[model samples]
Target: MSATPAPNASQSDAFAQLLRGSLLPTAVVGLGCVVVGLFSSPKAAWSAAVGAVIVLFFFSLTLLVMKRTADLAPTTTMMVVMATYTVKVLVLGVAMFALRDVSWASGYAIGVSITVCAVVWLFFEMRAYKRLRIFAYDPDGAASLETPAPKHDAAPTDREPRDEP
Candidate 1:
């Protein structure tokens, strides 16, 4: 069979962004925790990975919800993200606490990795937002419906009033 064609520049860029956004941070924290534990307490290192797996599972579920509900209001999306993060942190904390005698450095490593992932995700999101805003602001672009600004009062301003006062 013929060799497959290499991916285009944009595709490669997207893949790179995905790797930075999703994988690197998680791997960082996971590997860090495991290594730290390997020296201090091998058992805890293994246990921390299992715990991180559960947290990652929850993260995947949260991302799915966000993707499926993108058309929802900003407030709604914020609520979902916050709720998911809170739940994940609580569960992870409890699990780690349960293994109190274990080395705590593993937990630190896991936290660092997740933080790295979050930073990557935030960076990509900001980039996407910038692109969308730039496209929407293009002068030659097609006209589109504008969301009306909220009114502070119900007074009618359709016609000018007489200056009889």
Candidate 2:
């Protein structure tokens, strides 16, 4: 069978920008955790992988929500975010209860791995978000978010009158 390559995504896209910033660091930590776990025991290795997968999947969902709401009003976006979080929390609680007795994925290893992945992911995601262009002044906006301001003296007429006689 012949192998065909998948379509390429642009790095300039919002989703891609956040994905690169967050996924790289999370994946690195996950890989390291899994590698360390492998040396400890087979069960540890699988647990680490499982834990990492759970956190990564949840994070990806958050990013997807952001992308979908990028053009929405700030209030709307926050509402969507809160809704998504509530759903995830409910799902996680049920999943945790279901996995309470599972021995294949040790609780300790899973907890440690999940904790590390989550912290690393949050740190990287914060960094990435800070780097995103969000110019609030210009009508065109985000296009100039990272662009340097034009060098020019402010026009006197640009200022509004403070008082009238």
Candidate 3:
């Protein structure tokens, strides 16, 4: 079977808008971590920066996958989402284990920065979704009440009445 088409421009635009909304909070969290880490050590600052980058990378990847799969069937979209999440989590776990013992890496700084930035990103993303008016569900099948119904008087019938015998 032929593959499904990609999402339209508007869907892509909405994803982009979400990314934009998340950016400022993510950056602020990253910068705050870096500044906090600075007082500890250069390595701590670097670790926080690495954590920020990792979070940003994963978040962007998730959004990219979501955008790419938006036009597909719901099941296909769900599969993609699960697959991406699985891979992202596995990779992050491996990276954390590998970097756990590195002398220059500050685990505490990385952990704290990642945690805070992730929470911030999630909050902003939720807010963006709440503010967006992309979809509305109407269970009753009533036409949207936003627009006024057209005015139409009953039309006269084009037939004459028969006389009774």
Q: Write candidate 3's Cα lDDT for 1-165 as tens digits.
A: 997665496788789989988977898889999999999999999999998888889988899999989889999999999999899878766766677678989988887878788889889998988777755787565766677877788887998998989
Per-residue lDDT of candidate 1, residues 97-133 (tens digit): 6554545445544544344444544465456445444
Worst 10 residues of 3 by lDDT: 134-143
Model 3: colliding residue pairs = none
Evaluate candidate 2 by giving its C-alpha RMSD to the native, one decimal.
9.1
- TM-score per candidate, chains pooled: 0.49, 0.68, 0.76
Point to the candidate with the largest lDDT. Answer: 3
lDDT of 2 at 24: 85
**Per-residue lDDT of 163 in model 1:** 96
TM-score winner among the candidates?
3
Output the TM-score of candidate 3.
0.76
Which 10 successive residues of model 2 have the least lDDT summed? 3-12
Order the candidates by lDDT, highest first.
3, 2, 1
Better of 1 and 3 by TM-score: 3
